[model samples]
Target: MDIHRFFPPHEGISLSDLSGLCGAELADPSQVDRKVTGIGSLSQAGEGEVTFAVSAKNLPDLAKCRAAAVFVTEKMAEHVPSDVAALIVAAPQSAFARAAAILVPDALKPLSFTSDTGISGAATIDPSARLEDGVVVEANAVIAAGVEIGAGSVIAAGAAIGPGTRIGRDCHIGHAATVQHALLGNNVVIHPGARIGQDGFGYVPGPRGLEKVPQIGRVIIQDQVEIGSGTTIDRGALDDTVIGEGTKIDNLVQIAHNVRIGRHCVIVAQVGIAGSATLGNGVMIGGAAGINGHVTIGDGAQIAALSGVAGDVPPGVRWGGQPARPMRGFLQDAAAANARAFGKKERKRGGED
Candidate 1:
């Protein structure tokens, strides 16, 4: 992450003030006045930088860490180097995050590209469209008929909002992105080049050939959902495809029609979900995973990278493999296969001897 891109250079703050803000207790009172200018990782932090150590894995590097201040849990306090000031907290990473937000307010806020004119004159907007106060439409964007955009939303340059789409407040339709047949909630972000509410891949075998199924359902996205660049979400065939609140989907992900993803799900890049798949709350899908159609992944289930989930996954389990099974079972099978291969090689070597 480039710190300069997300945050401006912050004026140094006193260790005493920073510790108080993060609800962490300073280990050495004499170092309270030490100045902290920036934040960095344990390996990269230098003088005047504040870093964090969350577990024992980081303890080995504490002796070499050159940061002026460090955040640590109570148990890790003993490992802190004498020269470095330790700020103890219940959760080191969480406390460090809070400190970053305080020091860099711009990092938490949305990007602003507001021009002299509130709405761009070059943009093409239908007369019937309703745009609320503080909505900014950039150059060459199109707002189709019957579209309603809420307050503080931004339609970036070259973006297109299809007819009858309802967008809520504080939403951002990124540059060159397209949205159609969708109802979006507040605080939603559709990144650049994202394709939303497109027709699903539905077909029927007929006498003429493959018959196309008309997809008329909407894509309903709840609040705080962030769709990554180049991602495509197909509109449902009959029922709405719903993405619950706070779900973070990575780039190049393909979500098929009628797929319902629950709240707070983390879907990594290149993940493809087939139609009618249901994922319960807090589910995590690793990169390049394929979820079969009509399957249900229970709450808190974790799908490993490159996994092919062909059946329903139980709640609170870790699954992996081409045909995903329990993590433990998958590991055992791999170990057995490796052993058999090694034995066969040894027998061939003995026969040659």
Candidate 2:
């Protein structure tokens, strides 16, 4: 497919300009004026487009590429077609990513889902709600009393902003999302179906039954944080649950009460962080990892997919396993366990002998 039919193509950026934008060098100055209007994969890119090749495996594809320009390292530069402009860079993929930001800027953030220029007539805005000049409240959205939304923010269709909530400028609350008892910073993005500021799973055994504890705390999402679709962040029990600036949480994640996630952390999809868990800056958690309650993951640590974290993770290390531990020990244990279960026969992935 033609993605241009859906996302549309950029007007055009010359190869000379793209080299500077991507921090790459224009090796062939003669073809510097060649324009790139879009980007595609190695096998799929056509005329007036750009792509990148990072390794030897891409040589075959590079030879057949018909794009206007391609980003490559010096070693791979010879494989690029003579007709195609070669933008040489230390990291081809990184250069391509930079180019994508400039080329497909609309894909970076959600735009207006409807034709709404301002607050739609069908939206329910309370008399006490305060919206900035450029705020766009889409159809069927509900703005409760005392809610304050900043300029350039978009409350998409069916979103609900509860009373007294404060949203900063240039934020986007997605379709069908709910925000209550929360304070969102500038440039925050909550994708469609995200549930924010909900009650934590807190209860106590009473004489009659389990009694719900008062969830009086709020969620504080700092600037540039992006919560993915279907993610749920529970409100704190007493203290605020804070997401630091530039942290990106993927879809289907569950962040429980009192969680404090640090700046620039990357939490992958389906991860479950229990109550009171703290993650330090630059910590990267892979998909489906389960973090136990009250645990702390230190800065620059990485957790593998499907791992289970029991306690504190030290700074600047990698951990993986059912009960997560250092990678060295975890790998040894895994090999032994696998041998015992599978008759000590080494096999490739998918059990191929």
Candidate 3:
């Protein structure tokens, strides 16, 4: 797909300048004059563009690469086409990412939907609401009473801010997202359609049937957190639902009330973290995983995709499967199941031979 319509290529940068910007060692400083204006994948990169390769698997693409330069590891540098300048780095992809950020800075964050700066006139802001300088409230956005928005924050079109919520500096509240009973820290990015501070699933047996529990707690989102589009984070039952600094939550994730996620935790798409569950620092929960309520996952634990975590997990362990056992035990069960299913076929083949 042509992305130029949305994210245009940069003007130009010389090879030496790009190397320093991306922390890469230029193999041949003489080629410093070479300029690149765009970035693409190995196979698709053309003249005056940049790309990267990390392993021998990319050799076929690297052989025919037409980019002005290529980020590569020391081992892969030799295989790069002679026409392309090689930029060596320990982490080639990360170097390329830094280059992308430098070249396509706009792609890092969402641009103003209405293009109007400093509070659009069409936005409806309460008289009591406090907006600092450089806050951009786009068309049809609603700011409730007592809302406090810091400088350099953008409230996109149709987004709603509830009463008394505080948004910190440099935050982006995307189109149509709703924030209520929450306090957000600096550099938070709430993508389009994300539902924050909604009531959680809590009920109790009553005389009539089930009685709904009043969700009155707030959501505390720390700095540099990016919540994906369509994710829903429920308000706490009694305590604040806290998302730590730099935690990334993917699309369609359901974070229930009172959940505490530690710094830098990554919760992938469709993951459901039940109420009051606590995740320690650097924990990575894979796509579609279901972490049970009240369970504590230790620091650096990795839960595989489609796993059902019902109990506490120790630090730095990898787990997978239903009821989520240690990876080794899960693999053993899989191996036994495989043997059972294939044993009859093996016996039949032996008789035929």
Model 1 misplacement above 4 A? 1-6, 108-117, 345-353
lDDT of 1: 0.93
For all candidates in order, the CA lDDT equals 0.93, 0.94, 0.94
Per-residue lDDT of 25-119 in model 1, one digit per residue for the tens? Answer: 99999999999978889988888888899998998888788999999998999889899999999999999998888766665544544462468
Candidate 1 vs 2: which has more TM-score: 2
Q: Which stretches of candidate 2 lie over 4 Å from their true place?
A: 342-353
lDDT of 3: 0.94
lDDT of 2 by residue, 1-353 (tens): 55678678899999988999899998889988889989899888999889999999998898899888889999888888898899999999999999988988888887677999899999999999999999999999999999999999999999999999999999999999999999999999999999999999999999999999999999999999999999999999999899999999999999999999999999999999999999999999999999999999999999999999999999999999989999999999999998886764544434873
Give residue 344's lDDT in candidate 2 (0 to 100): 40
lDDT of 3 by residue, 1-353 (tens): 77556878889999899999898998888899998888889998888889999888899999999888999999999998888999999999999999989878898887768888877899999999999999999999999999999999999999999999999999999999999999999999999999999899999999999999999999999999999999999999999999999999999999999999999999999999999999999999999999999999999999999999999999999999999999999999989999988998899999999
58 in model 2: Cα distance from truth in Å?
3.0
lDDT value, residue 124 of candidate 1: 96
lDDT of 2 at 74: 91
Model 3: ten consecutive residues of lowest lDDT: 1-10
Q: Of the pair 1 and 3, which is ahead by TM-score?
A: 3
